[model samples]
Target chain A: MEQEMVLKNENSLSSSLKQMLLKLTPSIKKDGIIKSLKNTGITLLSILMFIGLWQMGSKALYNKEADYRIEKALTERGEEAAAAERACIESGDSSCQPNTLPSPSQVWASLQSLIADHNLIGAKKNAFAKKMAATNEKMIAEGKDPIVYTGRASFVDIVLTSIKTVFAGFLLAMFIAVPIGIIIGLSPSLRSAFNWFIQIFKPVSPVVWYLLVFMIVKTLYIGDSSDNAFVISFISVGLCAMWATLVNTAMGVASVDKDYINVAKVLKLGTFQKVFKVILPSSLPLIFTGLRITLSVAWMVLIAIELLAQSQGLGLFVWEEFQNGANDSNSKIIVAMFVIGIIGFLLDRLMLAVQNMVSFNKNEMA
Target chain B: MAYLELNNIYKTYGEGENSTEVLSNINLTMEEGEFVAIVGFTGSGKTTLVNLINGLLQPTSGEVLFKGVPVTDTSHERGVIFQNYSLLPWLTVGQNIYMAVKEAFPKESKKVLMERVKEYVGMVNLSPAINKRPKELSGGMRQRVAVARALAMNPEMIIMDEPLGALDALTRGNLQDEILNIWSQDKRTALLITNDVDEGIYMADRIIPLKPGPNATLGPEFKINIERPRDKTAMNDNPEYKKTRNAIIEYLMDIGDERKTVSDVEYKLPELTPKSFVA
Candidate 1:
């Protein structure tokens, strides 16, 4: 009877399953759902693993709570010393006054108070306005007369000016460098003639370029025109950084395989077509590599040039931070350094991402 | 005049004191749709001869003519397939063939061009690897793509510089049959540069042995009048096949012997080197 009942139940279950399948005629397929679910699970696991690893690395690299630990230790030591000194002073001891390292709480409170009092947004805007006004005022005063400095511009104003100058310089460098580089690379005769020039100028420092350009600007422009300063800074960065793109373009053009050229020949491809299609695409990887390196170098050299030339940008910002630290506040320079590092890292990553996208091999990182 | 001819061709490297002749007094004639195989010992200047024909190189003296005109630089009319299977690594099998097809028929509709590509790719039995790059394919597979690339253009003649030399015996034999089948269908004027005597005997209507060199020259042409669709296993049994194959092997062996001791007797230098140095 139990066996018969089991048979009957199995039959009923199979029939019920068939009926359900018939009723749900257009329902989602089981296999597709399972496949999608599996993929989602995999993606989630990978993301989790990445996050976990990143957290571990961050913890290893950064000591967020280190100040507290160090301060607690110093405080304990300072208190012990202070108690001993008190006892000694009662019996007449030298060095009896309590001298202790500031506690973690004290440092934190100091930082908080500084942040609260900074008026950072207003100060930056005011500095920018004042610098612009000063430049205008200086230009007006320099019209048949010398201008005098009423007061110093704030750090924010100095940084804004520096950034504006570097960007202008960088743009000029890019425009001049890319076309000349392409022409040099494509033509053997041109490359040969310019090879010596490239070798001579490619390695010169930005500081030297800035100094030379500064002298040229002063000699050329008698008035207190900010344009002269901007021009000097641009020339400094452009001269220092143009070689990277130029050499890369030339090397890229030269390194394009002979086979593709032959293919172009067989196809009866015109000069423009060959260059645009076969040569350009083939050389793109190397050219992009050069451009990426050149941009980074230009960014770095622009900063150096600005620092040397006393032009506006992050380099000047850093310089001002240093000056401020020397004068009164110390940690502003540290904050600025960290900010620069983070920005540079982001820029490098953006270039890397772009390189990956442009590369023929998707798996390749550079 | 024959469809194409090389008359008293000479290709020499360097000049004056350091001059070395690579091909000397080479002459050949090919009628339309003729299949010729040139076999030689290693360093027999067979590749140089084919390069001259393909217009990849110019003969230092004499003339290489396509129909009646001198061969100059590279042209699409004579398609070449190299031994190393030079397919652009960046492009897929389809793209490689498509490049040639597009070149050949610039005015053809894109749809028709695509169809021709598919047909030719299928001709080499590589439709599956159409989307796959050269790097991802096997050596045999890459050569198939190369053949597809050349044949898809429908050139008037095909020049192969040891196209199957790199493959193993089995793959080589398979490609040889495939090449023959393709040749039989269209009968494009074909010149194969090979060292394999049997391969030459099996494929070509005429086999010419390139004598080994300080300067290599074509020895004599052996005409193979064997019936079409020749069986590889039974080819050995044919007297004509055996005779021609032995003759080529003997000629190559003699050339190899001659090349072995060629350096011992060399003794001339020209005066230009001294003059140039003085100036």
Candidate 2:
């Protein structure tokens, strides 16, 4: 009898467990947790493998010539004299030859130092602002103009400046391209008239554009200031990036479905209404794709433009680090490279999200 | 005077030497509340005729008139239901209908507009799928939404360009009934262009055949004098239905044979050039 009772209890427990499992199963299916977990595991494993290979390769490929030179110097000179040179090489000194190809750890340390430098600059700026506030108050009471703090930009500041310039150029490109694209797309005569200009300017190099913009901006500004540098660089970037957006927008507008156009006509929609309601909505996916490409091009051309224009941005930072020729500068440049790649990826993802939101074609989301 | 008139309409495509006349001497008239179906075989310029009536294309020689005024361009007074179910794929069914309704009654309040959209959506029995995008809906559902959108505008005349041609048999029958039910309520002027003679007879007050083209013209009209609220089962036993069907089939067969004979004679071999004797 007792055993029979125990079996009934066990059956009840099993039934409850099954009920709970059934309830949780739908949640798991809805969330796709298993699929996401698999993806995460794969990504982590690949990243780990990449880091492991990089570490092993860097150690195996140590500079033999530099080691030989260090050994020869140690033997030729006394221990006390060579100790300083050994310390410099052993400490991963930037000025030494053996430290040219930095390991991942060195890059990480450089990144940390850059962040630290940014914080230090922020604190300095805060102190300067406090001092300036006090000085300004005093000057105001005395009826005189207050002085401004003109300091060197930090790494974070340079990154912000680059982002700002690219967006400015991108916005400028959008404003110039979309309207002209629509007008050209709508009228065949206008398209033919502008086709020659589009074909010729599309292939022109960003460097040539920079030179042209520099000549124009130099005459306009007539001063050597960072602001002037930014204006010239972004203008060049805008001119170079605008072509893709313009061409894509025109193509998109021109290829709009004939049925939709007929629908607009049948509805007696005005020209403005037709454009905004039908043409723009239908062509948005292509326009966004063009914008994405244009933004990437703008980013790529920024480094060269900044190097030539001497603008205070991440591009300038990279150029400066390359010219610095210090042992740590290489690692810093590597950090900058990673930063640029990650930011580009993020910008593309942002554009994709916007495109998906606006586009009716869900199959093309990827 | 007829509500819609196509007077001696002649339509030609291309230009000069290469031009082919697709439609010729097309004279037809539709009364204010009449449902007329233009039946034809493939390539009969039925679509061209529909386009001309819709004012999407102007005739090369003749004129299209609506309410005694020459039809110069497309207007909201005549709404079209296209074969491809041209609902904006990106928009929900409700939004698609709402766009037309808004255009038609621009001065209506938002609340009133919403009610009108809901009312028309309910008319097609597609209230459940109103918020679904066209891509998400079936072909029949999309066509139903197209019908709702066109009807919601309360157009004075409705032009259907083989709107049911792509649907399955069941869906086609269902939509035909729904369309007829909607028409019974208001008796609005509607023109259906279809290749299906049975569909034409079932829905239209009169059935007209368009002859095979290049330079197709309308043949004799077959009037359907059956009573209202037609029963599909009862149509089989109806004598008038049998007679009309036989007449249209015979006419179409004659044209088909004639076209075959013409094509057989039209094919000819090009003259062979003499071989050149250049060494």
Listed per model, the TM-scores of chain A against the true chain A are 0.59, 0.83
Alpha carbon lDDT at A277, candidate 1: 68
What's the lDDT of the predicted structure labeled candidate 2?
Answer: 0.88
Q: Which ten residues in a row have the lowest lDDT in candidate 2 chain B?
A: B259-268
Cα displacement (Å) at residue A278, model 2: 1.4
Task: Report the error of model 1 at residue A208, Å.
Answer: 3.8
Number of backbone collisions per candidate, in order? Answer: 6, 1
RMSD of 2: 6.4
Query: CA lDDT of B104 in candidate 2?
Result: 91
Best by TM-score: 2
Q: Which candidate is the best by lDDT?
A: 2
Write the residue-wise lDDT of candidate 1 on A257-279 in tens digits: 88777667766667887787688
Runs in model 2 with CA error above 4 Å?
A1-95, A137-149, A223-226, B106-115, B128-130, B265-279
TM-score of each: 0.71, 0.86
Cα error, candidate 1, residue B177 (Å): 2.2
